[model samples]
Target: MENKMNRRGFFAAMGKFMGLAAVAPAVLGGVFSNQANAQEKRRSAGPGASAVAGSMVDVNDPIAKAVKYVEDFQKSPASKGNKCATCGFYAKKEMHGATEVGTCTIFAGKLVNANGFCASWNKKA
Candidate 1:
């Protein structure tokens, strides 16, 4: 048999493509709209609101890796007596559930645990 897309097969493929194209905008819009609303709420809630519900920065996060961020200060021997809780780069600390989290100047829009340490750590005044 010849390896070819006959008229019927071509039409079927086109239909599938067209259907996905038609639905993509609505689906993508809803996803993006939810993110935008959440961001707006975070902004309105105050500068410190991020630690309340913001997503935690993963060790694998690009900036986190660049700064050698560690969730536990003890794991970072070079950090010596430094942690997000005492780092100048650390932003407001807040409780999310029972976990202690805060923001870092190096990782905006994300939260880091109080016990976390990073190369950017500076002694807080």
Candidate 2:
């Protein structure tokens, strides 16, 4: 009877171990995958992304071209009276080189000179 009891106990423990073994890899893989994704985000978020600075949009960028974005307001006659800083779509102003830059809603994830003007400009309320 004792022998039978010991065998049953061992089998129970073995069954539990097997269950854990089967499930452990999947759980651990998910944990590691999440960590990797988070690390990638942090790594890719370096220079181009900052609380004060963002990736600046170039005049030649597709969106910039579509919106007729001009780094200098004077360059675009229609943009003469408008400035990005006064625009409803611009925010997060930070100094970049000699001029201040801000993020424009029309050009997500990028910065535009505070003096820059775009066709999408709207007077800030």
Candidate 3:
């Protein structure tokens, strides 16, 4: 009876160890694959991927409203030193996925047309 019990215990331990060994490689492989995929996504997005969060404004559409806003700022004496490139509200980088479109901090969720302008423009200090 003692000999039979020892044999059964030894086999059970061996089986558990083998099962863990077999699963280890698959778990490690999955982790590595996930890391690789994350790296790929980061590489594709580049540095300015989050510059715009949503749909981009159409350049072909009339931007009179946006342009007028910029023109008003330009005419103001206080805005003499301000420009789209320097504005806090201006999107410094082109929108990801749509290089032609720009983004604006004030416009959240909407990509501004590259040529579009708005009243909230402010120079980056």
TM-score of 3: 0.43
lDDT of each: 0.83, 0.82, 0.59
Cand. 2 TM to true fold? 0.56
Could you estimate the TM-score for every candidate? 0.58, 0.56, 0.43
Best by TM-score: 1
Off by over 4 Å in 2: 1-53
lDDT of 1 by residue, 1-125 (tens): 24455877888999999999999999999999999998876776667545344789999988889989999999989988788999887766568787788777778778899989999888999
Q: Residue by residue across 45-83, what tens digits does model 3's lDDT show?
A: 545446335676443435534544442245545455554
Which one wins on lDDT?
Answer: 1
Steric clash pairs (candidate 1): none
